[model samples]
Target: MEHGIVTFLTDYGIDGPALARAVEERGLDGLFLTEHTHIPTSRETPWPNGPDLPRHYSHTLDPFVALGAMAAVTERITLGTAVSLILQHNPIGLAKAVASVDHIAGGRVELGVGPGWNREEMANHGIDPRTRTARMLEHIAAMRAIWENDEAEFHGRFVDFDPIWSWPKPVRVPPVLIGGEGPTVLDRVLSHGDGWMPRRAGLDEIDALAARITELQTRAADAGRGHMLVTVFGVRPDAKELAAYADAGVDGVLFTLPAEGPDTVLPLLDEWAALVA
Candidate 1:
């Protein structure tokens, strides 16, 4: 079980470098940061998780910039974007940013991506919300091409770019984890993503979740690929819950940390460290 944690950091929270150092010292695998380029105020799309949108959604820091700062300060702990909204940014530029951070982190970066749920938020980036899934897949393919080939190009309905040279190529291509839940998510992960990152509640039906994972792993084996990683996000830091996940063959569980100052955040980190230990 690779134990990790993700924190939604506000401006007033412990800065990225300090947070990274604190986690690394505790021997945690990594620290993930969440992103929201900007949250539109129109409220055109209903909040997916609750009655109200959380304040962190509107004020979170740029994951790439924060990860870069974290990378400079910490050597062992990995850094990642828990779920970057791929549909909200130009894939070419986003690819560059990811590679740059991976380089800075010495190859310790996980690129977790999602087709965002907010219609108005997608519109802000000139993306049609309805076409987001298709666009997200193409964007990922285009980014992979950029990372793998010396001179890469991709032409697709949503993302089209000519052969071009981009540099400071990543020390290693970062693993792409697809984040979502539904009947089709596993198929998508098998097709492109290196792993699956489902929110905790998505796995509430344990029997079905286990069966799905088994089926997905079988599919991966048939396709001549290694087993797909099952990582559950926002897991409560409880022993029995974690043991259940481990028993279910989950590769990792990411605990959520409050976006607060070190005074509040550090104690939680200590608790998480002991939990994982």
Candidate 2:
């Protein structure tokens, strides 16, 4: 069994840095926040969580900005974008941001990203939502090239460029956590993601997802790569639920709170901390 409790995902606004610090002060090992460029005024896609997406998603701050502030304040805690909308980003610039944060954190960053849900948001970024999965894969590949090589070039359909140099690299390329749980998403996790995030589900789903990750790890090892991390998001603190996750091979479980300010955030940390201890 692992020794940590959970990571966090929030629509954190102004106080993102303080929220992360509070988590660390409470003895949590990692803190993360979600990213969305802008929430469309016209509601087309149903909110993944409930009847309607909360208003805070529309008012949130940029994830990298929050993570950078959090990194400066905390010593050993890992910081990450709970799920950065990958398809919305320019891969080269996005790669630079990831590397910069990794360097600032002294290598305590985890990357959790998704293909994205809003069609308008993707179109706005000049990315086609239809090919999001493919784009995400190539984006990861391109980033790895930049992170691992002194000068690298990518020529994929979605992300490509001439061999250009980028520097200060990263201490260790931050862990790439693919954020979604479908067959197509799983295949990508098996292929490129260093971890799988089974976000927002029942305890039953946790067990099954963990099994799938373990199975994928076996397959990956056979393929000569090690793709063995399973980081579940929005965990509830029932011992049975967590034990179930551990039995299923989960590396970590991150919880979701309705908000991230001290009011909603602090007490929950105290409550969740004792469970892991």
Candidate 3:
């Protein structure tokens, strides 16, 4: 299975170019950055992982800009978003940014997208959290139209546009990986995504996760969509667990890295590199 790293590239963490270079030099297959445009200070929406939000949530650098910098410094590693919050950005503008970065990266871009968890954050973007799934899907469809056609147009409940011209189409349409572990996520993946990216909760969840992957693939095959890639996000560098995932037909695993400086981060990269090797 392909091994990769995922991290929140915060203002205080190891910078993108350096981190990308380190990942590539150590023979990792990909480097994926997390995204959070900004955090709402209301503190009303509870964090999914814990009581307090990590410092990186508000401090993250823009994923596309960081990925662009990473692209300039690296040659072989895939550059991607772990999960870009799709409902927060204008589809046309987001499409342009992704395509421009994909062009700069020579098509080495994978866009993992999700309807994010923060209610206040969505509210700040004028998005109703209840309708976010539909909006996210529409955003993706609109972006796909923009990427695939010379004069693209889309008419949807959330996104509507007359035929319009956009420049520097991606070297290819970057594969859209649907991100989330919700029960309905597989349905979304089969309908709109090139791949499925689910966060593995723990080593204990591997068997159940494998069964879900099988179900996803079988359903895709039945629908005539061949081989949906399954990438487990937030994995740890555990050999036995990785082998189990490989046996279960996962295409890739992205291990999480803490938002830390080189002294703390580089050694962990070395440890992960040993596993990759």
Candidate 4:
């Protein structure tokens, strides 16, 4: 299985170029950055992970810009967004940004996308949280149209645009990984995404995750789509657990690094790299 790292690249954390170089030097396969455009001060939407929202959520550097910086200093490691908030951005601009980064990375870019969880944040973006899923779908479709065509036009409930030109199309269409573990996530992965990126609940959930992978692959085969990739996010560095994931057909596992400077982060990377080796 592919071993990678995912972290919220924040202003307070290790900078992009240094972190990317460290990850590559350690022989990690990929480095994925998390995104949060801005955090609303209302604190209305409870954070899923804990009672208090983490500082990194509000301090994250823009993923595309950071990834671009990372790409300039790294040669082999893949760069990606762990889950870009699709409903919060304009698709045309995002497409160009992603494609530009892909060019900088020499085609090593993956886009993991989802409808985000912060209700107030979405509201601030003029997005209705209830309609976020539908909006996310439309945004991705519109972005894909822009990426794949010289002159692209899209007319949908959320995204509508006339045929226009956008330059630096991705070295290739970056693989779209649908991020969510909801009941309907598989359907979205099959229909619109190139892969399934779900968070690991715990070791106990491995069996169920395996079952879901089987279901997704079976459905994909029936639909004539082959080999759906499954990458678990926020994975702990446990050898037995990783073995179980590989046996269960997970394509990759991303270990999360806390948003900290090299003093705290680099040692962990070395440990995880040793584990991977």
Top candidate when judged by lDDT against the true structure? 4
Assess every candidate by TM-score: 0.97, 0.92, 0.98, 0.98
Instruction: Name the better of 1 and 3 by lDDT.
Output: 3
What's every prediction's RMSD, in angstroms? 1.3, 2.2, 0.9, 0.8
* lDDT tens readout by residue for model 4, 41-140: 8878889988999888999999999999999999999899898997899999999999999999999999999899999999999999999999998899
Worst 10 residues of 1 by lDDT: 201-210
lDDT of 2 at 186: 69
Model 3: colliding residue pairs? none
Please, what are the lDDT tens digits per residue for candidate 1 over residues 9-103?
Answer: 77877887888999999988888888888888887688877889988888788889989888999888778877888778888898999999999
lDDT of each: 0.86, 0.77, 0.92, 0.93
Candidate 2 structure quality by residue, lDDT tens digits, 1-277 = 4433333334452266677777788777788778888877876777766888777778777788778888898898778877888778887888898888888889998898888888877777787778988888888889889999998999988776999998769889988999887877768887788877767557767666766777888888888886467787778778888788778888887776555466765777788777777
Instruction: Sort by TM-score, best first.
Output: 4, 3, 1, 2
For all candidates, what are the clash counts?
0, 1, 0, 0
Candidate 1 stretches with Cα past 4 Å from truth are 202-204
Ranking by lDDT: 4, 3, 1, 2
Better of 3 and 4 by lDDT: 4
